[model samples]
Target: MSLAPSSAPARMPGWLLILPALLFLVAFFVLPLIDNSLRSFEVGGEFSLGRYIQLLTDTFYLGVIVETVVLSTAVTVICALIGYPVAYYLVRHAGRWSGLIVFLLIAPLLTSIIMRTYGWQVLFARRGLVNTLLVQDLGILERPLQLLNTPGIAIAALVHVLVPFMVLSIATVLQGIDQRLEEGAQMLGASRWRTFLEVTLPLSADGIGTGAILVFMIANGSFVTLVLLGGGFQTLPLFIYQQFTTTRDFGMASTMSTILLVIAMTCLYLQLRLVRRAGV
Candidate 1:
């Protein structure tokens, strides 16, 4: 006797599976952004571009924009310079210690940002370890130097915080590269430097691009680190904070937020293009 064919369970639609996530984003992310964008244009309950005009035209505001871009660029460059070597070592030679290297790289990220920033403050304070070491131990300075709340210190702190991102990005790309390729290059009489310059570097460009985009986007929106360590440096975030809290100009604050969002979106677009070009 032949048995009746068993019925199969119906499969759910892919969109249905993600409907909750979509609704959550709409409620939390999309709605807030739309509200902010609308507020930027609203002046006394009417649409106006006065806020944008002022932000774009005023030299002080313009300077803050330029300074924000410049600071992000500097941080990106410095992170790249510091991260590449550590990534190279991690990927090429870490061996059994790779886990330890990765742990160290990620440990700082697990700490609270406020705590990390305060740690920097302590190290750079007037009677801090750095001042003590330079003046008393090393005799490098006649007295404690003013190290805290400066642009250089801010940049250094940012680099210290962001370099791990760069290293991890580059390390991920490096792991995908074939060892045979490097060995072949060496066998063809290429020196280690030449092999790296021509082969490894070119292949790892996508990682550098990805890391640069990440670092730049983050540095653009950085508030706490800059606020504590920047010595009154004016960037868009700080300016936006001042506009909201001090000047009580919500419209201007919203406009600055919109501008910062645009900048971040542009960097994200570049990152996507880079990923696509790399076939990743």
Candidate 2:
């Protein structure tokens, strides 16, 4: 005998709610990626990775790749260092001031990235505030220092810009941690540092992992920061931009972009594995 169908239609509305987002992703994200991947392989309708192969063979492109990796690694480490203390403070100490502190963390993020980078350009210029302070006010330097358009400046700006995301991510983790766990550790005579290392740190691993992956992805594709701050040097994103706009080499540009995407995905995958092993 056939069983009578029982209606459980509630799940259908939930799926309907997400359908718009699914359509948007398909239209904007998935389709574009597939199209770009196809474009990277073709030159006049013939399939080839000659453009990508050229990128590896070219010393300049290789250097761009190395620089991109180094910059991202440095930014991620700096963010963690700055973020951990802030995260700890917000979670444990800030109490009545937590809301304001969270707002402060988000303040710079609300500012436009291009505008922030431009602000750095002005601040770091030879005749800018930095040199004015050092040379005129402090009488420390004989000439204006070369702060603008350098790797150091780029990394500094990057850290400044991205630190909030790290803080937020870490704070999200900290918020979820049971206060009882830390109180228990303290009651058992564990030091604050010991409690953090043994309990808080482990519990917050997932948020840290998410933040690191997110920041690294942004750092790797950094075009404005690298361009304005690196002083015309090329990371992969900048190279791809130049190829597309300056040289009008769509094939090569698409290839470079594809390589960047692959690298980003690979790094994210490794981070996922690490976070899993870390038991986050």
Candidate 3:
């Protein structure tokens, strides 16, 4: 007698199943990107690289791009440093307060960005709580220092806004790790620090990369925080905003936008490569 076949039936092609989503992306994302890129090259009713050439030759624009990158990188590093410890604590030591801690960490995300930026504005004002303590109570300065619209304040606000993302990303990864591995390492003559360095750190590398990418991308594209907290500092996002709104220069705006897009994509690609190579 012949045996019955036991294989599963053939499934629909993966591409066919995802065709709707692919079409949506092509229509909304790819088409817009192509249009903007083409717009960036158009000038005087003809195809030209005038916008890009102008951006390259303009010292002010170049400086804004540099500042934006520096600020974004700083925010990413700060978020990682602060978030790693918080995530580790939540995963390993929160105990009874884990729920409360997680709630507090995520609560800010529910608030509007405009509201958050305004809150920072009030706190960083000349006579705000910070200056009151520094000047009146502590005598750190003779008078209120200018904190609003400053680079430091911008970084601080961005950190506050982005740290939760870092925390969540890292905590998700940490939760998936087997506690026994850490216990095993420590039981086998390894110190806590050694176990973390050798096992936990490597294991959580992917989370770190993910968090950094999210923070960096958000910070790089930020306009609200810089506007309310950066105190007249110009970044690439602000430049793009002004080009379109103030100057009515769509070509220039499109050029800066494309450049920003390229930078963000490059960083994302590099981070993924690094994460993959680390086996994370």
Output the number of the lDDT-best candidate.
Answer: 1
lDDT of 2 at 49: 74
TM-score of decoy 2: 0.84
Candidate 1 lDDT by residue in tens digits, 1-280? 1122233234543446578999999999999998998999999989999888988899988888998998899999999999999999999899999999999999999998889889998999999999999999999999998999788888888898899999999999999999899999999999999999999999898899999999999889988888778766889998887887789888888888999999988999999998898887
> For model 2, how many clashes?
0
RMSD of each: 4.0, 4.4, 4.8
Model with the higher lDDT, candidate 1 or 3: 1
By TM-score, rank the candidates, best first: 1, 3, 2
Q: Model 2, residue 187: what's the lDDT? A: 99
Every model's TM-score: 0.93, 0.84, 0.84
Q: Of models 1 and 2, which has the larger TM-score?
A: 1
**Candidate 3 C-alpha error for residue 254, in Å:** 0.6
* lDDT score, candidate 1: 0.89
Which candidate, 1 or 3, has the higher TM-score?
1
> For residues 46-94, could you state the per-residue lDDT of candidate 2 as single tens digits?
9987767877898877787887787788899999988989998998899
lDDT of 3 at 168: 95
